[model samples]
Target: METLLPKLDSVFSTDCVIFGFQANELKILLIDRNEEPYKGWRALPGYIVGQDESIDDAAERILYELTGLRGLHMEQFHTFGDVDRHPQGRVITVAYYALIRIDGQQELKPVTNFARAAYWHPVKDLGKLPFDHQKIFETGFRKIRRRLSYQPIAFELLPEKFTLTQLQTLYEAILNRKLDKRNFRKKMLSYGFLKELDEKQKGVSYRAAKLYRFDRRKYNKIFQNDLSVEG
Candidate 1:
């Protein structure tokens, strides 16, 4: 192994931008950097990969160390290898973005010396961020919006049991367009993935709508291979 090794001039790292939906707005988790170059600036939590760790392993390890989260259904969407992406040296970073439902998780308290705090910032009103993160964030947000149109991704962003109105609101927020409720509900219902609960939404002033949950078993059974709609 030593004889087959060639000297390397760069290190690999993974930076994850975790997006969570709450209060009907898109949010991204950022860590306050405590290191130099961009110290005290907010950035996506990331760390250098271990010498023997795989890229996937490094990503999950970085996520857990920063957010106290694991198994986030993460996906590596892009690889950012700009020569100056890192001021430290030649560092190639694999950028990953994920959407983890915040419905049942504990408050994130990132555990790392480089990061002083971890918090969720609304995607709409973020100011300046460290590195090329603003570009990375924009890329991820665009992908999410495009994915929401053809896929039932609202189930991932919403609570366990939500009203159709709430689901439609999520789509509106993502697509930035209002959808006809009758048409939306009709198409959604035709899918047969929503399981109507015997319960109604509580704590609302107006006439409460019934709650429904996404049936994964039925969903997989319905669209097992390709995602398409038939008229």
Candidate 2:
């Protein structure tokens, strides 16, 4: 009789809770798992670690393998290691998050065999998820909310060419607060980071508003100090 291999006590994995904002709504990326334990349920994209690569590299690899996305500018938010988080074995999963414009929804494909299908689910009403995915998503969502306040990260969620309303909506969505139109525009323009272009918003019934681009160089100069972009 052939001898069986011994089991390892620990396993490491990386999970991504990707966020996409469109049409005044936020959605998360979920995959239909084809593996055991949760064969048909929706869950965050994740996979086991590699013996040769570090956790960071593994995260990028797993994300690309499952989502068919590359160069996401990924960020590691937290490390979840609970004894009962996984059903089959002891797994320590590091969760990450990404921001995509979703302008190219067709680009998303399931590259791995484990994921039978990949789709975006609205945040307003999410169904039951596998493992502690719900908790991981809650943590990632809160992290992005805090990051959006200081870092110039909202640009990732916006379109290449956008109007002021679209920009402000991104902020309001993250901050969950209403902002004064005049005050907000005045303050935002005063910073000089937004360059007013000759472009105007089209397809609107009302007076068309001018379009602008966020200036990276000017942004660094104005708020070089520990300034905050609250919400």
User: Highest lDDT, which number?
Assistant: 2
- The TM-score that candidate 2 achieves is 0.86
**What TM-score against the true fold does each predicted structure earn?**
0.88, 0.86
Encode model 2's per-residue lDDT on 73-169: one tens digit a residue: 6788999999999998789999988898888745677788988887778886777889999999899989988877567778777777777888777
| Candidate 1: 10-residue stretch with minimal lDDT | 222-231
The lDDT for every candidate, in the order shown, is: 0.81, 0.81
Question: Best TM-score goes to which candidate?
Answer: 1
Model 1, span 1-231: residue lDDT tens: 457768876699998888878887767888888888798998888888988999999999898887777777788888888888888788888888887777687667777777788888887778998788887878787888777656777688788988888888777776667788888888888788899999997888999899999999898887544222223
Residue 28 lDDT (model 1): 85
- For each of the candidates, the C-alpha root-mean-square deviation to the true structure, in angstroms, is 3.0, 4.8
